[model samples]
Target: MTFEWGDLFAGRISGMAASEIRELLKLIDRPEIISFAGGIPDPDLFPSAAMARAYEKIFQSNAGAGGALQYTISEGYTPLREWILGYMEGKGVRLGLDEVLVTSGSQQALDFIGKLLIGPGDLVAVTKPTYLGALQAFSPYEPRYVSIAMDDEGPVLADLEAALAARPKFLYLVPDFQNPNGVTVSADRREAIVALCAAAGVAIVEDAAYAELRYDGEALPSLAAIDAARNGGRPATVIHCGSFSKTVVPALRVGWVSAPRDVVNRLVLMKQAADLHTSTINQMVLHDVVSQIFEPHVKRLRVAYKERRDAMLAALDAHMPKGVTWTRPQGGMFVWIELAPGRCGVALLERAIKEANVAFVPGAAFFADRSGANTLRLSFSATKPDRIREGVRRIAGLLETVEA
Candidate 1:
């Protein structure tokens, strides 16, 4: 007799679904398709030489390959933790080594946060069109989401105040160049949000995955930075998650959570329970590479990604049909487009891939409440300037017929 696997599965598995971007990636791998479906860093810009040198150094170290392959503490490798501390200090958060815990990626940090704070049916607050990956991470815990409406400057204060009344476990935000929509929360809005959440005794979960990938404008203070300033350089109200994926390389799978020690201590236990810590060799290589060329590598990315961004915007301006509007992101990979009323982004994506040989993520996937049917997100991070222009033009050409 066959057993029913579904019956044995956890109930939380029901809330989890496959990522749309991941699904789209499978379809867009053909050379004929000009795809903007994935918000990923371009591999051509990766610091391959530096990374190779890093791996070489690991073997040449006094401890040799055995030590490199050996398990590290759940808290993470020491030199990497020290580097993270200094990086946080540069950003004004002033985190000590104990306050930081390295995870496999920021995605893991989010999952841990969900496990730590969300009870079944607990309240979780997210931006109206927030990152889909965050929703996927938090959904496994089965929290009821309260979507906060946002303006160009970020979350609306009145809406956030109303959301605060319900007392969500945390206000999750991608404050700097937010994913999908690419709207950076203004400095004033960030401070106000930090203050409002702190006043309500709510926690703020800050996802800064794209913070280092800024292509234009001065960087605004992060939610964690604002909260730290208010609490005298201690992480009081915000649990900040940062990633090396967008900055250095995604394959290394290195990222971290910077918070108060107590919270980190709890997460460290969870880290131990989950995977017994991130790969020791990967962390060692990441530390070596970052120590050598982190800043200059990031600078090169900004320049290349900025060109792609400009190309996509210019193509949209020149080719997009009437009744379309998109966000002018200060610095990020995405450009969010709102099609003329009654045009669903999903339908457009279907036609775009089949007919126009182009693809993008439908905006509805990014919504917690599953709103924004007429919107879509196009990513410029992974494509070259020419390909970006061609993809935008193709999408725009499709919109002309669909919108009409």
Candidate 2:
């Protein structure tokens, strides 16, 4: 009569690991803690009023209410897909309406891309300290990872060429203001990567979630754009994933993939089996809100996040002891910090919560190889400037203690 649930679980379940940031979020709920662990957008910038108006407008008429509330095509709402096409084209990555497949969020697109491309023991090329969520998304598929080294501009071309020799299932890149690291691939490097990958018959999964969140420096051409240019405006070699969560509203859960027609079709099949489709009402409302106020809203976010980033950078400079270095991100929510040699970020995190009352994600979680024990990622998006200053100061104090 006893139930043994663990014995009945699938083999893939064993490969899954909890996200460290998600776990840390549960323990840092105390109002007194100055948490820098989550890459969350500031709630103050959400377009609540505009979203409300869009929702009200959608329900104002019978035709509007019926269409929005009803289940739609698995490919996604047509108008939204068309709008995204125009948006991508404007950014230099030309996409037809058929090339776009809307998903619950770009997170879902990651999962679908993994499902489409990765198989057990297949190799995937990734940046050394890439996005943590990508590693988590691909882990259940049981793929091996080849981490290419990165420099200030982006992945080292020589290292990338060596990795490409393995003929990975695909190369995953977070091109603009990459998560955790906040480094953007330069335009020249983007072209080189595209040419090399295309020549080698490899595909690229371009996660552009934070591409639109730049705070400084001139914008670089996206890998998708360069790929399109190389392929004569057809994105045959790239599966570009983008999300509205960072630039628009996170709660809306709207994101999309722009790829070749065949890839789009395959992803649609996977998407249909996964969730039928993204929420009908949410998609409609997102399309409405974006049509009316996207530019102004994103501009507001850029200004706000830029200020927070500046504050964090200044605080780090003023407080951090010698040998503690960090990246000066051009834009994006995170700043990657490296502690002095022999320092452990995981150990520092434990003491940070208990003694310093500040929290951050250890860098090990972001590395597919589980290296970078002396590094950490600090997110400056959700906290106020004053809290950012205090948090960095507290962290700097902890580092000094470690040095002593």
Candidate 3:
């Protein structure tokens, strides 16, 4: 008889599955595949030179090296948290150091929030076709999900109001150029949504991973910012998860969470228990880099990514059949596509890779209710504009073949 490790696994393990996009990303290594499956940053855009200098400066100083190499506090480096406070204040949300936590990445922040708030059969609200990573993080904790359907202006107000009526423990959303779908919630809707959730005594977890990557439209205030306004610039309902991965680089895995002091305190304890804090050296290096060039670096990314986005939209328009439709995102890494009736995204992905040497993520993975069979997500962030055009053309050609 085989030694069954499954018998000894935690019950939560049963709810976790390998990420669908992560698996598809493996095809990118083959060289022949034009993969748009993962919404990862382009390596070329990473501030490799700045990062090298930051590390060199750290090690050159004996005092800096000693502290960096040593384990640090779970609450994260104080100076970094201070920087976060300033950044949040810029967005009209005021935060104290005690209300901040430096997480390994925003992904960890989501997991911590899930563990903090979710219990077996607890109700959680999520946008329809939400971030797959969030669903993955929360699933292990075993909360049932109620999904709010989204329109171009963001989650439909009627749907959100209905979801809130169920008395969920929290509502999770990516307000700024949401993942899988590139829709940003309008300013007025943000206000209405904040007020509704606050009134219902429901917490909001705002994932701002792609907030700084906008290419069009004026920047809107975050949910935290609006909620803070309700209570004299203090966090009232929103827990914001922010990341440097989209703007800077992902390898260092630096992200942060800001919430009310008590919530942050609990998360800090969880952080201490999970890994005894993020890498001290990495945190210091990240702090140094962002402090020096965060804005200019993000500006550069916006330009480069915007070109690729235009190329993808153009290619889709030029090649796709009339029945096919896709969203024109103002910012972020993804373009969401919806096929005509009776079509399937998964089937199209299989045929695209096999016959056209292209790759993308089927949108059903992002749906907590598992309903988006004809929808898919394409990422233009990593590929060059020419390659993005080629990839979209190939996928469109393949899609046509399937229709025939």
Question: Model 2: residues >4 Å from true position, as ranges?
Answer: none
Backbone clashes, candidate 3 = 0
**Residue 23's C-alpha lDDT in candidate 3?**
97
Candidate 3 residue-wise lDDT, 1-404, digit = tens: 79999899999888898899999989979899999999999998899999999999999989989999999999998889899999999999998889999999999999999999999999999998899999999999999999999999998999899989999999999998899899999999999999999999999999999999999989999999999999999997999999988888898989999999999999999998999898899899999999999999999999999999999999998999889999999999999999998899999988888888999999899999899999999999999998998898888888778778
Question: lDDT tens string, model 2, 1-404?
Answer: 99999999878777689999998777557888999998988888999998899999998999999999999999899989989999999888877788999999999999999988898999999998999989988988989999998888899999999999999989999988888888889888898998999999999999999988988888788888888887778798999999999888788899999999999999999999999999999998899889999999998999999999999999999999999999999998999998888889999999999998999999999999999999999999999999999999999999889888
List TM-score per model, in order.
0.98, 0.98, 0.99
The lDDT, on a scale of 0 to 1, for candidate 1 is: 0.91
- Per-residue lDDT over 256-359 for candidate 1, one digit per residue giving the tens place of the 0 to 100 score: 99999999999999999999989999998899999989998888888888888888889989999999999988787899999888889999888988898898
Model 1 lDDT at residue 147: 92
Model 3 spans > 4 angstroms off: none
RMSD of each: 1.0, 1.0, 0.8
Indicate the TM-score of model 3: 0.99
Q: What Cα-based lDDT does every candidate model obtain? A: 0.91, 0.91, 0.94
